[model samples]
Target: MARPTKFQPSYCDQVIEHMTEGASLTSFAAEIGVARSTINEWMEAHPDFAHSVRIAKAKCAAWWEKRGRELAVAGGGNPALVMFGLKNMGADDWHETQRVEQKTTLEAVDPLSALLTQIAEGGRRITDRA
Candidate 1:
């Protein structure tokens, strides 16, 4: 027998409120006395929970972005640390990117033709030696 799930409809609002305050999903799980994997399971089992999680993620990113903007305007916080946090915590909204282009050509060769060429070269070498 499995243990009863701790999922509740109120958890949807709780997660949104938690993450909107710049708290991580893992921290929310810890706050609710659940494992991170349990949170994932809840999302899979509950559609409302999944939607709330999505909203929570966006709100979390917005919170980080707001903090970054404040630091940039006030010139009081460690800019590098704020940038690192934004890049990591709000990666979808803040991060550096690079673009690369590559070109290549692939030619198909007949295995039998290659083998025959090698044999012909060996025959020429033998004739030259003789």
Candidate 2:
């Protein structure tokens, strides 16, 4: 039989709070005197805890983005770092990517054949005018 888990229900709230506050799992585990691998195991075993962690991660991303904006407004932050952080952390919502799709119909006729046809047509017109 497998040994029982060391997870405590009491730590749920704190874990969620810390995650939303931008505390990584490793740091949070260290702060709570738990192993990082143990936390990951708890998340896998507890569906509710996993859901809470997901929500907290979104909140953490929002917090980071807000901080980036505030720093940019204050003009005291490194522009490159701020942009890189925001672009990576808020990629789905903040990153900009352009997609252009051009569609064309292609025929099996060769380009030289088409050009020669045009020239032949022009020659016929010229001869008629002569």
Candidate 3:
């Protein structure tokens, strides 16, 4: 048998209110006396909860961005730390440059050698054409 759920419809509003202050979903879960995974499960089971969570996420990012902007304009606090926080908290809006690398390998094989090697090595190539 499964345990009873602690989810309530009002939690949707609570999540948005909590995240509006730049709080994380994890923190919200902690405040509500639930694990983070429970939040994910609730979102999956309840569409309204999922929508509320989405809005809450955006609000959280906006809150972080607001702080970052305030610090940038005031020039009173550690700009680097604020930038780091924004990059981490508002990753969708603030992100560092990223580099991606792709590699391709080309191999040449003679058809006859490949066929003969395949026969000799039980359907496997023995050497590459050079």
Candidate 4:
């Protein structure tokens, strides 16, 4: 018969919360009054624990990325509008929708306006003082 381990439910919950909050295994172990090696063993023994954290982190990142995309679209990517969305950011914020209206090659503007616009747009929000 297999021996029952002393892995308590509270301990497991603590581990999961710590990991989801971006703590390292060693840090988590320390936070919960356990040895780093012991926590590592638990992670190895309970593959689900590690998998859950990986999925959670990926989901969080995807959500943030998607939010940026939505904001970009909602602002119509106008420099003023985007800036408004970015500035005074509480539930909403920005700058003068800094993006070019769209991807189009027009002789009225520079031939490579579209390309340069694309490159410039890529520079948006690179420095997040917000």
> What TM-scores do the predictions have?
0.76, 0.58, 0.73, 0.33
Better of 1 and 2 by lDDT: 1
What residue runs in model 4 are displaced by over 4 Å at the alpha carbon?
1-4, 53-130
List the pairs of residues colliding in candidate 3: none
Q: What lDDT score goes with residue 66 in model 1?
A: 86
Residue 42 C-alpha lDDT in model 4: 65
lDDT of 2 at 75: 71
- Residue 102 in model 2: lDDT: 100
lDDT, candidate 1, 1-130, per-residue tens: 9998999899999999999977889999999999999999999999999999999988888888888889978879778877876787689879899999999898989998986787788875434654
Query: In TM-score terms, which candidate is top?
Result: 1
Error of 1 at 53 (Å): 0.8
Model 2, residue 86: C-alpha shift (Å): 4.5
Q: Model 2 clash tally?
A: 0
Looking at candidate 2, what is the lDDT of residue 92? Answer: 73
Of models 1 and 3, which has the larger lDDT?
A: 3
Could you give candidate 4's per-residue lDDT for residues 4-99 as a string of tens digits? Answer: 654555665565565554345566668767787775666677776656545544443444444567766785434554333334232232224556
Q: What is the lDDT of residue 43 in candidate 3?
A: 99
Query: What is every candidate's alpha-carbon RMSD to the true fold?
Result: 4.3, 8.9, 6.1, 20.4
Compute the lDDT of residue 47 as modeled in candidate 4: 70
Task: Give RMSD (Å) of candidate 4 vs. truth.
Answer: 20.4
